[model samples]
Target: MGALDIFCYTLWILGSVTAFPFGDTLNRQAVLKTNIQTTAQFPNNTWLENIAVRANGQLLVTTIVPDAAVYQVDPTQSHEPLLVAKFPSALACFGIVELGLDEFIVTTNNWTLSTAASPPGSNSAWKIDMTTFSESSGQGAVITKVADISTATYLNGMTVLDKTAGTVLMGDATLGVIFYLDTYSGEYEVVLDDVLMKITVPGPVKLGINGVRLLGDELYFTNNNQGLFVKVPIEKDGTAKGPYEIVARFDTILDDFAFDTTGNSYVTTDPDNTVDFVTQKGSVTTVLGNKNSTLVAGATSAAFGRTFEDEGILYIPTNGGLAGPVNGTFIEGGKVMAFDTSVVA
Candidate 1:
């Protein structure tokens, strides 16, 4: 009401914008780029846990809801996810891997800390058909019951390896172990174990392996709590070598990563987290974060499209503040965010 009060208000506004421009400012030095755009969101029944893109440009995503369905989303459509297949009595579906044309694999996390009832065998691997997205026909796109790794609590991340060997690699968040499985014979082997325990850090003990991506002969994964992107050398036999090496380290929590064709790696962090791009020479750049007006809330996972138009665009899935208290009040759930990395860096 008074002239002095008005002057003070104006100065406060200026200070706020100058100090923190974004609505949810977490990292001060990181610049939030404008090219990032939202793609889709699942509110009530759709709790998307993991995503995998097929060679035909179709996106396959798994959910944690009661029905435990796998969805196929048209890349051209906006937030429209068509339910392909639903597993009965399955609670949480975590990871997905494309096997071939109209075929894929999914890993389920039966035991969730947030839920009361747990599915039989903490985690089970299943094979599904992409065309019909069903396991019933036993002829068409069927869901073949695969191995159950009950010993591993949460089988979180998955990626397809050399198809000639019919092997797929998966990350277990509950036990911090990585397993390599033969798709044809159902044979499985542990490639890496206790990865977080092996890493020496001074902070509070946090051990969970989330995202995994295979680049050439090296396998790169994320240690969520430590905010570390680690690489392990894989032998010709498809096994990992000695201790895994830390490729890039960050202060914030990391979710998933996308590799560009040029061998550059782009990783997604928390809603208030910063983006870290690592070059082949081991250089790191913070292309997006708190410095700009664009705010990333509850960013969970990211994937790089193979096509030229979408190749460099990073597809990010957000919870949009719906997944409970962990995401916070400002951040909402069920929204997909796309960031054009080719132009940003």
Candidate 2:
């Protein structure tokens, strides 16, 4: 909350996380891995909003409504899901990001963004420490509320940044702004905001900036309702260095995205029921989904695999089938899906 230099924490690049070389090598094939009806966990009104991949090949999925459960899916195992932790049926779960080896930060909604006894719909972020998490021991991730973020309008997507101190950058889907969170002090600061982030086409889903990621000094985010993807370079202190750059515009609802070693972006188109393979050149290509009932619709988030069994693979989770069908109506439970890049490689 003070000067950026006072809180600036060193940004760590774990493994090859931010080391990719952007290009054609990322425009690979996308194959459907699984849908909710076919999955072993979450077969109800669980809206799997976001996902984070464990280096061991397991995935942590955060749900949206009905049931606030975090299920762990292991492809290397029998593919059966393990219960990591379930939140109160009242609280809301949205997007998640890996903080460290077994630590993570999760974005939430429903509560007022104030510290007083207000109402729901106000958003916030949380920290899940899994250093000692173990299901066999009847123990799991230790969850804690990140202080001071009660003022967030609609905390949606998140990206970790040590901008002077331990922090995570969060995007408010409704406010069209990104806030820098001080993980240690519990304070936050709005680091970026622009007209491009405001929901110009307020529709049934008027979300502004849905997903965000930082590569070097560049910040990438989705203007959901506007169907636009944008990026901008920021100074070391988290100030914008230049104007917003248009990455691409799509015909469908662009929800969230993930980056691969080639710097190619894999984006999910919500109601369109598809994922787009976006190259660094700002070209859009369909890699998964078909707007059908089977593949995966309502895709709210994406992340690349971190384990050997899943490395280079793009992992995705859906908002069940609650987002409405393009041609008809149906009930789809929250589920996890993935794309195997080996065939394209």
Candidate 3:
């Protein structure tokens, strides 16, 4: 038989038996999709910019508003109230990563410290302990400043290397450099200096190497304004040991991404409100998202579910609402969405 025949025959036979992980008994149609729904909206956000699923299955998200705060979502309760970890007026957080035990490392740009005469406020990173956090109190959480990038051009995303040693790394969007911080000393250093990370402003779009992910022996990051996907092999200490290589290029402008066990990337296309899949073999395809759908407006970043039940699922967060290709299809303010990946071909 041919490839198409094999696919059709299989769909006609066992599609019903394998529907649990993919769907409920809503309808009687064959399991044509990997899941019954392409994406499910999780109602949490005011201007969410990034998302990371903790080992404990809590959904942690970051916001972009001046009154910015971090939030936690409980997957078990469908209508659970958002748990907010409020930040002071001077600090607004962007990127966040889990550091175990309800603790997280977050990146910040203190816009309040910016002066009308000099460069923008010096950037910094922090460790937020949500252990005894109370959304009502909104101010007593234990917070520590990790990296003080007083001279940093612009700081965006971050990743943790050694939670025990308090080692964290951040990407500079404006100066094109990578800096690692010693959480213990609260000091940071320029560890990687490469032209490949140089910032770009094409017409009106301003972005650079925004988000970085450390794979087994390599690092992958998104260069937005340049529309290039870059990857570099690194040493055990996180220093680049090889020149940056272009894995893929697109005109859509990529944002943050998460990799599956198969090494496939679930990447976000900023204003497009779309998530594109970069397969393990280097092919690119769109998974769930439409220019006109509020389903995933201004899609910013994605992370896979860590629970045994949700292992391969993808959770995407948006930068609120924006205009799509359609005449009136605009995205509403921020949201967190879960997309069924088994649906992907």
For all predicted structures, in order, the TM-scores are 0.78, 0.83, 0.80
- Backbone clashes counted, model 3: 2
In what order do the candidates fall by TM-score, top score first?
2, 3, 1
The number of the candidate with the highest TM-score is: 2
User: What is the Å distance of residue 159 in model 3 from its true position?
Assistant: 1.3
The lDDT for every candidate, in the order shown, is 0.62, 0.68, 0.64
Steric overlap count per candidate? 13, 11, 2
Q: Model 3 off-target regions past 4 Å?
A: 1-45, 79-81, 111-119, 133-141, 322-329
Candidate 3 residue-wise lDDT at 77: 48
Given candidate 3, what's the lDDT at residue 275?
A: 80
Q: Write the per-residue lDDT of candidate 2 for residues 1-345, one digit (tens) a residue.
A: 123311221222321223222222223344554422233346766677788876455688887666555777765546467767766623667677777767778876663212211133456667788777764553667888776366677777787675346677888877788888877777788989898788888466567888888766778888787878788877765679987877777767788887766566778878778778787777676767677745776777777665544565667788755676546776677677766755442
Q: How well does candidate 3 match the true structure in TM-score terms?
A: 0.80
- Model 3 has an lDDT value of 0.64
Flag the better candidate by TM-score, 1 or 3: 3
* Model 1, C-alpha of 45: deviation from truth (Å): 7.1
